[model samples]
Each structure stands twice: as C-alpha cells, then as structure tokens.
Target: MNKGQISNTLRQYRLLYPLDKLRYLVERNKNKKLNEKFKKDNPEISLPPDYLMYESFQIDYSKYYFGGKTTAEWIFKLLGKHINLSGGKILDWGCGPGRLIRHMPDISNDQSSFYGTDYNKESIQWCKNNIQKVTFNHNNLEAILPYEDNTFDAIYGISIFTHLSKEMHFNWFNELKRVLKTGGVILITTQGENFRPKLTGEERKKFDQGELIVKGNVKEGHRTYSAFHPDPFLKLVFEDVDILDKIVISPKNKGYLPQDRWILKKKALV
Candidate 1:
C-alpha cells in the first residue's frame, strides 16, 4: 500500500473501533428515532418496503462516519470524461437522493440527458422535488426498468455494487448493459485491496473486538458489502466490453475504505 492507502487503512481502523460500539447499539435499537423522523417529515409518504427500511436504518448511523461528496465528485469526473455526454442519455443507476447527480457538473453544455432511480420512495420523491432537470423513478430491481434497450449512452453505479450480492450484481450488470448503447461507457466503484479483509487469528480477534470490519460476503439483510478482486470480477461481468481504465483513489478525508473505479465501454461491432 502507498502512503495514502496506509493512512486511510489506519484511519479506518480508528474510526471503526468507536463505530463498532455505536453500530451495535444502532443495530440493537435499529434507529427507531430516525425512522420516526422519516415518517414525521414525509407524512404523505408510505413507509419504505421492509427490507429497504432495514437497510436505510442501518445506513443512517453509518453515514455519520463515512458520508460526503468526495465519492460523488470522483464518480462525476470519471463519467464526464469517458461518457460521450454530447447528445447522449445517462442513467444514474441506484441513485440515492440524487446526491451524485446533484453534485455532478452541469454538463448541459454537453447536451447530455440525466435520469435517476432508486428503491426508496422517500429518496425518489426528494430527488423529484429537488432536481427538476433529472427524471427520477421509484423502482425496485426485480421490476422492469422504464428505459428501452440501447437507450442510454452511458450508465453508472457508484458504490452500488459494493452493497449487493453476487446475484444482484449480475442482474444489474446485465440490465445496465441491455440499456446501454454500443460504445457506451459505465463506471462503478467498490472496496479494493487497500481495504483488506481480516484473515489471521489476530485480525479475527480484532474484528471481534471491533477494531476491524471485514467486507466480503453478506448473508442477510436487503444489502451487504460484497468485496471482489477487481480484475476477475469486472472481466467476468464485462466480458463483451472493454475495460478502459481501473484507477484507485485514496480516501480524501478519512473513515472510509479506499475505492477502485472501473471504466468500461460496450464493444462496438466491427
């Protein structure tokens, strides 16, 4: 690991130590206060689906230590560079509260169109209210996406795959590819080697003690962090595409794992 990676790893460990206790408490109580606040704030809004509600509750606490606009900027930069936005459509897959889209630059000069979707009704409503230029939808993964095949010039899933199971990832991967036009680009980010998983006896003990959090397979809940070797996984999912770039960016401030950005392009017929 480089200096920045090492620093991020150490910072993550320190943040996790205290956060573990907080997470345990939040998990035990399950953010009742937040849920009530959510309901109170949006009186007309129906409660999130059970699974989504649980995931939202868990993330409420986690966001304190690891939420910011840096990741959004990172994604925006990558997408703006590779995606031929001029007269092309783009999908912000799994767009949460329109954060990434909101932070994204006004590429209106590029004449690029923007669309966003999420499983959280509250979030989608908020996006609709806040971002007038971008179209937003409240939809689940199992449902057919509103877009037609070969509709988008590019699509992005920022930190979306990291929280999904392999099956879910495969489903979205295929779906996103189906909607993308030939030569379209897709950018996604996930936890990489800089955020190593615990393995040794000491590491396992540290994990039990809350000094470490291993992100790999998740067995339950609506979402789980699923770590992967970037090359192998991207190769498998994007076999028919070209991996234009694989860049690692260290955490800018602190309290988050280092991330890898995968830039892929759908292959064009010769």
Candidate 2:
C-alpha cells in the first residue's frame, strides 16, 4: 500500500487505537522542548494539557494559542461583516478544548454571548475549568444538541464537518438549522476540492461528480475519520439555506493545507 493507504488502514482499525495514542505520545514528547519554550514565553495564558489540545487541534502550545487566536479574529471578522456581532448569541459548535471559542470575548466587541460544544468529555471539562467568559458543554455523536430553538444568532464549526459519516451530515445540519434564529448565519469549514490531490482514483471520480468522500472505520468525531465535500454535494446539502459566501482557502505556504469556508444564512420559515 501507498503511504496514504497505510495511514488509512492504521486509523480505520479500532485495534490500532492504542498504537495511535502511542504515536501521538511520542510525537508530543519529541516536541516538548519547543512547547516548553512556548510556556516560558507566555506565562499568563492558561493552556490545556497537550493531549487535550491534540484531541482538538495541535499540540504545539504556541500554535494552539496564536493560531487559534488568529483564526478566531478572522472568523469573527468574516461573520461580523454579514451580521451584527455586538450582543449576538454566537456558538462554536464543535469547539475543541476552547481554542477559538476562548477568544470570543476579546475578539467580538460589546456583549456577545459565546458558547462552545463538543462531544469530547475531557475537552469540555478542561474548558469548563480553564476557559473563562464562555460556557462549554459536552455533546453526543448523534445530531442532537442541548439548546432551545432559535437560540443562536450565529454559529461556526471549524473542521467539524470533515470528521463525520455521511448520515451525520444531514442529521447535524438539520439540528444546527433548528437552533439557528431566522436570518442567522452558520460559518463552517470543510475539506473540499483542494484536497483532491490526496484522494485515490475512485475517491477522485466520486468527488469530481460532486459527492462527499468519507474515510471511516475509525471512531466518528476522531481526527482520523475524514470526510471530503465537493461543491455540488454541499450545494445539495445546504439547499435550504441561503449561501452568503463560499471561499476556498488555498495553501499559500507549507504546513497549511486548503479547505473550503462556507457562510450560510438560515432562511425564514414559510
């Protein structure tokens, strides 16, 4: 098998979950010196455990903080242009360890209420203790979330859609739509066309035809369980919502891969 195939095999098997953990542990240890320097540099910022950060984003403390901070600023900027962020109800739908969500208070002006939800219990617990000014909740793998209808003025999930099975796409989108206020916006990032270079022959064919490409067998919501979206596929899936903007972020430098950013607005009920 090729490198990608071998990786897929390793991630797909439940039996290899232990191996996966071991691999990350080794990788984390290898990067300890660098992270320690990061800790030394930023003595005041509350950082999560390395493993918890890995479960959501990266292990590098500097990247976790600066990168998440940059992303938070950018996302709010994107959402702010279309919506009134001041005093808005904003949610980080798949907030991992409170990386981006923690910056919500500082990034958005005025009294915007911020909430974050994730299926990872450990991550949620960590956020509860460490992340201030934002409420955190643990969610289920299923589409359901613990919130009242029309509760959010805006919602965003970074890389959340890229880790699910086919069924969850429809289910989760519906649930998100249910909680969103009329004319509310949902900003989400997905693995899209730019990831085609990584797809196999068959996966490429289906993707070219505008289908979602899923790589599963691993636990859902895990980083290894990946899903890819084509334009046509997303168009069909988000048919009910009004697409405000769709931007494809191509890699401008190494270590940065491409992903599609979608801005959608909930339509008024008839």
The reply for model 2, stretches above 4 Å from the true place, is: 1-3, 11-19
Candidate 1: misplaced stretches above 4 Å?
A: 1-73, 105-110, 198-225, 250-254
Error of 1 at 34 (Å): 17
Q: How do the residues 1-270 of candidate 1 rate in per-residue lDDT, one tens digit apiece?
A: 553344345445655334444665566467667756756765754332333333432334223112424555556567768865777788888876665565444635436678898876777886787666788877775635778889998888766776665566667788888888998999877655555442344443543443323343223212433333444555676687889998886666655566687899888778
Q: How close is every model to the real structure, measured as TM-score?
A: 0.65, 0.95
lDDT against the true structure, each candidate: 0.62, 0.88
- lDDT for 84 in candidate 2 is 92
Error in Å for residue 118 of model 2: 0.5
Using alpha carbons, what is the TM-score of model 2?
0.95
